[model samples]
Target: MHLILWRIKMSNDNLFSKAEIKYLIKNKDIVIGSFGLAAIILAAMNYGILYLIPGIILTIAALGMRGYKIYKIYERNKKIERTRIKYNFKKIKTMDGYQFEKFVADSLKLIGYKTELTKKSGDFGIDVIAKIENKVIGIQVKHYKGKVGYDAVKEVHSGGKIYKCNEYWVVISNNHGFTRQAKIGAEKLNIKLYDIDDFAYLLDFK
Candidate 1:
């Protein structure tokens, strides 16, 4: 419990906050880098190495900040990878429907798939559409406690036709997985069903 809480804290993600706005105001790399360049220009003046020293320092700091930002993103993705390995669905269940759809689309992108989220209201039945190479997949995302029912599978199966998808799927991240009827219908309709266990592979795309 302590470890999990610590991990979440270190992930630096909060439920709500304008972190981006704050970052842009405080840590704009272009502004810092420009200052560095200006300082380097002072090196040509009588001050010489004195200004040059601070210029190099600030330039390096700007680069290091950018690298750190990239590293943080890589670490965030790795945390998702760890969750997949641990088969932890509880965190995923906390997301709202729209959040769940976005999360699924983001995961697909990590593994080289180009993903698009359908409109919230007029999406037919699908939440996310993904493409890799020649294949187009329509996916319905469910982030619920109970087992996903047959209706979800049927809905995605039908939605796939509207979107001209080559494959269809119903994905649920909760532990309950899919009902027997859902599994049956998915098989008959050739629609894939991804329960908690099967859903883990979505992150790795393997």
Candidate 2:
């Protein structure tokens, strides 16, 4: 009975794995590439037929259809990637607020920074304490489903000043990415801001 239960668990695990999602993405890309090539060929044939307006219109329509198909495929791939990351994150053992901090600390350690998980509540925006090159660095980690705007960055900068640390880092888990204004704010405050994609890269997720 135990053997049967173990086999069932293994089968269920394999059924929900990301390997299938990756295979589907590969097939979708192949189909998109073939459609793109066909559209290009049709456009080339229609280019010389300046008088055949209908043919030109049909070629343009085909190109647009291919573009829409490719866009949908890319969107689906992004969703799959996000789901995979979320699943991996859930598997790590950490509390709600501590999860992002733990991930940052692990990544920093991987990059040769000595990290300490702090319990200071008044940290305001700061999360992790890191030591590098004989200097203490304050890290503020934010896990959001939306964009990390100027306010979040400003809070981290202020926390950095309060802590009197050598440097400050604001790491956000989710965002539409940084805007030009947010980048300028970071520059002015001399603080480092990392978005979801940048955090993933630093953690060697991809």
Candidate 3:
């Protein structure tokens, strides 16, 4: 039934797929690393004292900024991890879809996954890209009330492949869980579906 439809949809994914942007925002380290290396090279080449002084100062400032950014990222992720353990999604029904996606990204961070929040426009149905070790995962967040239908499942499954992700997931906040058709479609595509129960269980991770 839905499984057959899933296969057909995936077969056409490539034809309909947009060019994958695969864009990651640059961090401060890239500039800092290059500047530091150039400074060392300049010093070794016996550059004039004026050039050496400014280069050394700029490199030091860049290093400090890089360190601060890394620490802030670490702290932010830790905060999210703690919030997941203490917070109950059922109690907070007011969060918008964007907020829900952020929560999901935070949970993945606790489990050693680095999450990249995709842009709202031209995201190709993916909300977050989670990477852990060598594996990359595509996740779509659904904040609806009723059962998650086949569309959400199909979108993540096909879009994930187009995005070159190794795995895909659909996170549905609906307590009623997925419809039978949706489940069948997801199973056919090997896409993991997470309902409210599964999210609760994740909070209990050791």
Candidate 4:
């Protein structure tokens, strides 16, 4: 049984992209458990506890279907620490550009860098600057949806020179992410792009 499941996962892992893999692993428990629980609730409301026993068992079975969520949550929480800044996807999606930039700065500082936010006016393009010993990193925050274009890559690349930054990055709220031209430009310019999924680990929010 275990061999068959392993073979199935091994075959399917090669068939899916990283983003798709994360989405499936991250949401599958919730989706399946929710459906099972709803079914159980409906059965309970319509019938007596005696008649609902099968439904309750099915819900518990579903909850454990993909490696019990209880263990998964415990394993996941074990890695979380008291980060300097706490953030979540829902809150991040609602923040304005200014708030998002500040959050980025705080998150960077959480990981040992000294960070500063550039002024709103006449700042050229850098939204945040992070320094650690001799290295300086320039960052731009975009709390927006849709594809980020080559222009954003250009903005940080040029702005990095002004800030004496040795590295450059763009933090984006949208996971759909950068345009093809933006990706090409980033590769050529040696800039990294962080969509929400990437930043989640970077920030290490609990």
Candidate 5:
């Protein structure tokens, strides 16, 4: 598998181009042809009564080989997903606070909201102010590396009240999942919190 991957990398200057597509299609066709030939050979061998044991053993081997191939495919897919997420996170990490703020503001604006970037941190914990229609929304942005605890949620909620905003949003990066207590706190305070994964979805990363 490693050898095949290395060969592919060595041959391809543009993996997404027409040449690569043709190569992939040809490889897939060859694999299907090989599997078909193997099945035919196995079936032909089963015709002889004396060859029953050997045929059964061959079929079992084929099944095991297929299973191993399937497992490898699944593993490769998982690895690809992990790599994609890592790349996205690294890209986000390279962005400064102001850049992230602008990104978020642009994203919101795309969704039809007029946004205001606040340089002066609001006492109520608001980092951004957005007005949709006549409603003002307070936003707290957290570029955290670790878990955003219940306290973070509470602060945003309190800030919403102090700012007299219609709604509150807490945007966090690389934080522990909101626990049950945090959920209850958010519900009680009527504050909405979004994790990094949620932000990615909201921003349409994919």
Candidate 6:
């Protein structure tokens, strides 16, 4: 019988992505004992050394082992799929500032980014610190019901410099979006801004 081996890399972010686990399970090695035990049971029964009842019991046990392995793989796949679903972020009409930051972090995880929430006491206006493709990003989440102004942009720009991140972004979950001054400030500071629609577009949730 042919043999195969599969190993998944474990990390602090996650054990494996949904795609990786699916690939591994697809090539999972079939236990050799299935054919070997069945053949031995048949041979012993034919030689009259083993009774038919014992042969049937051993054959069932071998098959059970094989089935159990397949079941475990199925369970693992289900878990990974569920995790992927959790990252899907739809329209948010009402969420607090902290909730919005956590929601953004979940979406980033779907796209292969690891995120951490900064402490509220001394975060320097940055809410989320994301590491994406070896690039660190400082994000400020403003879940305002009204338009965000230049001050929000200024805070994120300052936070980015203090955190020493490669990139900086200000995301606002506001219907009114940003003011003209805010846009101009973001442009001058080279900071990315994401309004409600823009935020969804970035995550491809739209």
CA-lDDT, candidates in order = 0.78, 0.66, 0.74, 0.76, 0.67, 0.72
Clashing pairs in 3: none
lDDT of 2 by residue, 1-206 (tens): 23433444457557645555445444544434454455556656775444355444545655676678789777656755674375465443344657767877876787688998777477667788888897888888876666667876788778777777888888876646666777779888898887655565555433
Which structure among the candidates has the greatest TM-score?
4
Q: Using alpha carbons, what is the TM-score of model 6? A: 0.54
- List ranges where model 6 is wrong by over 4 Å: 1-91
> Which of the numbered candidates is closest to the native, going by highest lDDT?
1
Write out the backbone clash pairs for model 5: 147-176
- In terms of lDDT, the poorest run of 10 residues in model 4 is 76-85
TM-score of each: 0.56, 0.50, 0.56, 0.58, 0.50, 0.54
Off by over 4 Å in 2: 1-95, 204-206
Question: So what's the TM-score on candidate 5?
Answer: 0.50
What C-alpha root-mean-square deviation, in Å, does candidate 5 show against the real structure?
Answer: 16.6
Worst 10 residues of 2 by lDDT: 1-10
56-84: candidate 5 lDDT, tens digit per residue: 55556656666777896776556545643
Among all windows of ten consecutive residues in candidate 5, which has the lowest summed lDDT? 25-34
**RMSD of model 6 against the true structure:** 15.6
Error of 3 at 54 (Å): 88
Error of 6 at 183 (Å): 0.7
Score residue 160 of candidate 1 by CA lDDT.
86
